[model samples]
Target: MAISSYDISSANTELARRAGYVDAQWALPAINAVELRRLQRRSNLHATLSTSLWLGLTVIAGFAVVATAWSWWSIPSVAVYAALYGGASDSRWHEMGHGTAFRSRRANDVIYYLACFMLLRGPTIWRWSHYRHHTDTIIKGHDAEIAFQRPPSVARTLWRFTHLQGGSELLLRLVRHAGGRLDDEAKELVPAHERRRVVLESRIMIGVLLIAVIATVVLRSAIPVVLIGGSTFLGGWLVVFFGITQHAGLQENVFDHRLNTRTVMMNPVFRFLYLNMNFHVEHHMFPSVPYYSLPSLHGEISSQLAPALPSTWAAYRQIIGAFRRQQVDPNYEIPLELPKIEGDARPVEIGAESWMRGPSGEVIVGLETSFGLGELRKVDIGRHSVVVGRTESGSLFACEGWCTHAKVHLGEGAVIGEEIECPKHNARFDCRTGEATRKPAKDGLTTYPVTVSKGRVSVHLVGIDSVGS
Candidate 1:
């Protein structure tokens, strides 16, 4: 009746096998390195052409509206044109905001500043807040965009604050928030220098508003002034709507990419309108890739992009349905604890050094358990643990690490077909794909790549086929 001691070597071998351990000796299909490079070049070319076209159209439309100002019908015509222009310009701004609009950094900055002026938004403020959003896409309390859903008190406060201002006040608050000052509150994401810049920019905008007001009063025509102001405010609303629709109600998962974001498939026309931003999941997976190239990238990695929202129209239906039910959950919390790593696991070096090397030369030393970028840290597990390894057929899979949902490892968790029933929460992920098959975890566990080199074994540190390739 003596309990046997845990064998570290056996455990390591098992983990390796479950992780889709590939043999270096076997000639796996080599990725078309040349084609990947060509695709990247093509992506860049497409981005440049698309951005240029949008910019040209915006300039043309702006001039056309201004030139037609003498006509009686020009006002409404201009309003319609302005709205379309705003949409197209905002899409360009989004592209430039991600630093993907142009190959050159300085060129992107110039384009961003111009687009910001056209959209009546401060470039510095938008960029800082946006950079933070990218860093913490769905992390509540950290991600500014998705952090609004919270305790009743906070939500009520925000709702009241935003509601008090019909539109002008909202614009003012947004300006103040972007400028590193949130309605007498200190800035959360804006840097000190940037905050000063925002204040200066706000003063300039105020001066512009005063001049417009004076001109309207002197001319005894307030209609045009209202149109301009309303356009700016409406532009902000559209931006907010776009942001909320993408990941507002989705479950949050700090370590799991699948639950962290949602994807929306749309027809080519709608895709053009959205600038391919509907590919939210793919964008989250590969943020460096430009928006214009997202559709193509999604096609290339279709298998990994499963469980998507099917289409933009369907996603819109879900949004509307949730709103009708008043069951929108904006702030879904993600577990912060790292998954337990057993055996001789170590930390993965994930800086420039790791990124510079090819995947074949890279070794996955640990698992990434955080939303933002950085080195992957090692986790210490106590007794029971889930071991993910490869099969004899060279297939990858997962069982249970320690189900944070259930509080037990695979030993206690029941294995049912391709899923491991968490002894604690009943949460499951297809160990093969590391995707959540069920919820209550609303998240999935960490996955590592296993490969055998000669007689020794190694885990892939660098992500394979994660980039444009």
Candidate 2:
């Protein structure tokens, strides 16, 4: 198949669809239950400490700049201040946006909104945009956030260091959004119900900057504006410095992250600022795994992935070479060296088993005796892949197999109490009602009425509303 042209217009088109680039299922390395449980655990204390340190550093840096505003020392001070306020906020925004940084959902929201304003991104708009980013990943014309599109623009990449072209464009978009005007892509990516919130956030962000501007005017000094609204431009270099390493020079329209995403080792300070996102490949593979747990996740899956660059410099060396090649040959991609692992070469098992009919017109999923308590199984009924699981009480429950958030098979996920957590992003849904109970999974699953009789488990093929009736 011909490669996709790689633009938003190509999304869901025949070319992209024929290439298996639209809504494509991806494979995951085999992991045991115990290892998954350990990686998925969330801790409030760990998130609290990380957030606290970030906030503490910003405060210290802000005070340092204020104390020496007119001195030569202030130049370095402001750089540190801007890095904390603008650069580091990018990572904080990303982590909190995933809602994986904190055990408490409210805590994640608090930091997410703050970082959104600091980075000048509309929270609602960005949240949905990021959801799409994960779903399509590096697929051209589908992923909204593909940095350094093929035929890499050297001038534009260099301009981003000053946040001039990119930052200005974002500010202009915010201004338009503040007036309740959304661009076509924004309207398409953001749900209608969410557009209002996106507008509201835009207004709030603009209002905050207006306040800072007014403060600067009244005080007859640029200090207020410099510290608040102007930092994004001065300190945005850090964002570009770290962000470019992630999929910058990698292939697009590929289903696997190992071929398209990169992982670079960084010093402790850079990791702290970037919130361990240097492990970009691992993060993309398991977005639900918290930032603190990424190192362990890397340790588990590193062998299956292309060898990670030992340092940021090493990664940049590769990236620069790819950029040079892609400038002339757009199809050039850095080959990934993956280690051989048993059964790693097979395609993902999806829609693997067909369902049979029961005695009373019920869809027979499987023999109840074969499905153990607390075990999840995937059953294909017609075109649908349904996840059927037995609770600890031996009660059968069934929901759509694919996660509402990213379309990953739910049978591969963990079952907690009455909820099934999506393995890709940890979004959870109530098994009985099919109501989404977590972030990123705003939509719920399609549930089916399940029954066990005469040693067989079957699902009612009626609509969701008639389930369990």
Candidate 3:
């Protein structure tokens, strides 16, 4: 019998790799660097206020559940509690994990760990898992986050509504990781050095759950467990309700999110609960864009992408039809009328036209008329790569193209307070001076002398020989 194609180690993995699906650069909508940078902005106040509201409501619901224990009212109270604790936590887990939720790295991590515990996910483990998901969305044998695998099982998909089966699987994985055993998929996704952190986090999570179990036993009531661990399953239905609409029955292993993802127009209430994830296609296409800015992003690129579904009801109807067909036809893919793509849509900007030689022997990077403030663009000169940016105050700066801590392209990161922040790890660097200003990035970047002159943004290689020597 052949191993499942969904397994990260299966032969299908190599086939996907050979077919150029694994970690392949996907097509992007025609949003320029300037507009994207504006959309990618993070707000600490937005994150804090939303988090406070969510947690505040959860606490109130929890109190209601406790006050009405074993009564008929407890039913509705518990449901509300679960939705707040488990359901809402899913979005928080995702956005925080993306590091686009909070301007402060610590703020993001604090909520990330809390949500991971609520969802029974390992912080370190799922962080890398989600990165892979973005790198290979819905690609068979590569994307670990593909919720609805092919030969779609209606039973499993419906079972997910209860959150029992899925939540239990996460719990089982938590236990296994606590025992210091890494699965094949985990091994494949997480770095070898980071595996130890997974074990440590798993053990910590299991210890907390064990305490909740012991408290339930000591109190001679299910209240303790119901309030703590049980909420994960109870509220999980909301997670499925919003999550299934994201990519279910859509085309997979494709470079275009418009083909593989769905965006739904939602009411203010649903948008609040799901954090604008209703713009699912937009989020997947531009992962760096914060959740709060997704709506604006959709508006910005709507003309270049697929139309958003009119409503969640409409999305479900379309998905159900696709699911029924897929049940019998494993190769079935929902037909999508993809927009015509003309130029390379990947974010990186390269080639001779992107730069020119200045009169004073400096290298012109981009035109001042086009390079808006906060815009980050990558320009390559032969083997050397440089990222050119115009700070918010209209100051021009240039530095080594990638993050010093990781190979992440600086052009993909956000500009905040004269600093460039890494999209992956939240590391910060002084954009003007190229100093490593934050953690996870100890080594500084090599800054180039940049000046805007005569409608041209140019960078003089001041240290071409002596700035460092």
The lDDT of each candidate is 0.48, 0.81, 0.83
TM-scores for all candidates: the values are 0.54, 0.84, 0.88
lDDT of 2 by residue, 1-469 (tens): 5644555553444566576777787656655545655676677899999899989988998888889987999999999989998899999999988878887778999999999888888898888888778877988777878877888878878988899777788888999999999987788778787788888889999999999999999999888988997888788899999999999888787778888899998999999999999998888877767899999999987878888899999999998999899999988988876775459644333324457776777888777787665567777665667898866566689988888876678876656557777866668888889999976688999888998888888888676333321
Best by TM-score: 3
Q: In model 3, which runs have C-alpha deviations exceeding 4 angstroms?
A: 1-4, 10-12, 341-373, 390-396, 402-409, 422-469
Please identify model 1 stretches exceeding 4 Å from their true place. 1-48, 59-79, 147-170, 174-186, 218-228, 235-237, 324-469
Ranking by TM-score: 3, 2, 1
Error of 3 at 464 (Å): 6.5
lDDT of 1 by residue, 244-309 (tens): 547754553243344556677777765665678878766655454567667766676545433567
Error of 2 at 273 (Å): 0.9
* Candidate 1 least-lDDT 10 residues: 22-31
The CA root-mean-square deviation of candidate 2, after full C-alpha superposition on the true structure, stands at 4.5
1 versus 2: better TM-score goes to = 2
